[model samples]
Target: MRTVGNDLVRHQLHENRKWYLLLGALLIIFGVVLLASLGMATLSVVFLFGILMMVGGVLHIVAAFKIFDGGYRWLWAIFGVLYLIAGYYAFTAPVQTAVVLTSLLAIALIIGGIIRIINAFMFKPLPGWGWTLFSGLLTLLTGILIIASPTSPFWVLGMFLGIDILFQGINYLTLAAAIRNIPPSSADV
Candidate 1:
């Protein structure tokens, strides 16, 4: 028995099921292609990041002029300039950019894992605290391995991106299948 909200969601999903299917197929193909050409994919990711940083810089500069006032305006402008410089560096030296980004990712993961472990201990009285600690330990180990691995900076980001896209495509495919299974009510016709 479906609630009204569930029925409505089903109806909407059913209506857009084809789009989901198409997106899923496209993403899956792209993910496979990325995984096949890891080096190219890595460079592509770096280029995309550069483009995003440049776009952000432009937006920040625009905001400084159009939205911010007084000291905020200067701060925004300064940030915009910094973003632009970083973007330029990313574009000019993608390999270096990847190394820097990978290092940052490892550091962030380590910090996040430590925080989670601490939180798990703090919440020891709560159920599932053990799972939290386990997850934190796993994350910490992964970060350590990434930092220690020689190949990490070259392909880790691309590999992660490919896997993420693959999972997302699977998710969409599953959603589409579920939507297709939904029964059409009289109102749908």
Candidate 2:
């Protein structure tokens, strides 16, 4: 008769939903804290930032897996490169990295606003045009604000980054948690 111990030798550990939840939460919080550091850092060891960046890139790539488009895959791939570059630069040249990120955010906002405006015009027999126009205006204002104070946009960056990561972590944890509530697979266990 095979004992439980014999089975234990071959049985794999069930997925630890809690562990992934903790990791996701930690990654999110850490990302924001690092952003708040604003090019100022004092790590006990070297390459910490780089390692964090690579992990961040991988997370983003994984997130992209749910998206349904070749374009999204490419986007995630490019995002991974950016993350690695950002992390490397943060560790090696924090000041420069800060400047670059600050500039990039401003540019991206401006372009996003322009795209919204273009999209707004493209819609005909305009349904919910008012909301779209309002959103566009808000986007423009955000872009302008960034342009006005690009040197120190940490407040905006920190707030937005924190909010985004917090929500993302919550969403992922929720999905994982839901798996537990569902019935286990019916396949012969």
Candidate 1 TM-score, C-alpha based: 0.91
lDDT of 1 by residue, 108-152 (tens): 889989998999999999999999999899888888988999888
Q: Please provide TM-scores, in order, for all candidate models, with all chains considered together.
A: 0.91, 0.53
76 Cα displacement, candidate 2 (Å): 22
User: What are the lDDT scores of the predictions, listed in order?
Assistant: 0.88, 0.63
lDDT of 2 by residue, 73-147 (tens): 878878977887767777886555555565677788788887777777777357986677677778877878877
Q: How accurate is candidate 2 locally (lDDT)?
A: 0.63
Return the lDDT, model 1, position 128: 94
- Per-candidate clash tally: 0, 0
**What is the Å distance of residue 49 in model 1 from its true position?**
1.2
Clashing pairs in 2: none
Q: In model 1, which runs have C-alpha deviations exceeding 4 angstroms?
A: 1-9
lDDT of 1 at 113: 93
